[model samples]
Target: MDGKRALYYAAIGIAVLIGVSIVVSVVSALLSLAWAIVSGIVSLAVLAGVVYVLYKTGAWLLGGDDADYSASDSVGGSRSASASTDAAAESRQDRLRRQYVEGQISEAEFERRIASELETEEPDDVDRKVADIEQELERER
Candidate 1:
């Protein structure tokens, strides 16, 4: 009777496991179906957007607003962007000179700053190059 009871418990445990597995598999299948539907919707939306862009681009190449793009006509200004940057640099140099003449900055500081602006090379870069050359010369010796 003891052996029979043990066998019965083992059979019951297996039955419970089978039931739990069936429920889990059913839930997994439902989740997979939901994911497939959501992905299909997203894919359709992306495909539609791609088609619209292509159609508008082709229309623009032909120089007619056939597809009716929502974006405004122009993306750039008339003048080159670098023109303002160059003017700003010239103004800054003039200001630096004026400040130095007015005694607002020391002569040494003014000279160093002017060199930095004119050369566009960092002081550290100069130091690094000198170190490299010295190392090369030492290796040759």
Candidate 2:
């Protein structure tokens, strides 16, 4: 009986030691991961700053396209770019609406995603595109 009791206490102590080691290992790993993520972000930010500075310097040296960069003023070029971009965005929204209607996505998620998509573009253009989609939906119904 005395030997059995000693063995049981030893087993419990071993288990406690193992548990503490595991916990310590997990904490260290998490800290390392966090440090790595922060370091990576700082590095990327510094690289981006360097690239931007170099681009600005090069642009200045080349007499920056302020004079002949009027490509956006072209009749078809800018209009086509705008129209295609709007169409792609409208299609994405339409797919999201369909997913919501089909119960594949929650209304809240749909609203959040759509709002994020619209936020990237001009408010008036987004509004007009949304109105056009609404009209098309009404016609379908």
TM-score for each of the candidates: 0.45, 0.43
Candidate 2 per-residue lDDT over residues 12-77, each given as its tens digit: 999999999999999999999999999999999999999988887776555353322223321112
The top-ranked prediction according to lDDT is 2
Question: Could you give candidate 1's per-residue lDDT for residues 109-134 as a string of tens digits?
Answer: 76677566656544664454335434
Candidate 2, residue 139: lDDT: 53
CA shift at 57, candidate 2, in angstroms? 1.3
As a whole number from 0 to 100, the lDDT of residue 20 in candidate 1 is: 99
lDDT of 1 at 51: 100
Q: Give residue 6's lDDT in candidate 2 (0 to 100).
A: 100
Clashes of each: 0, 0
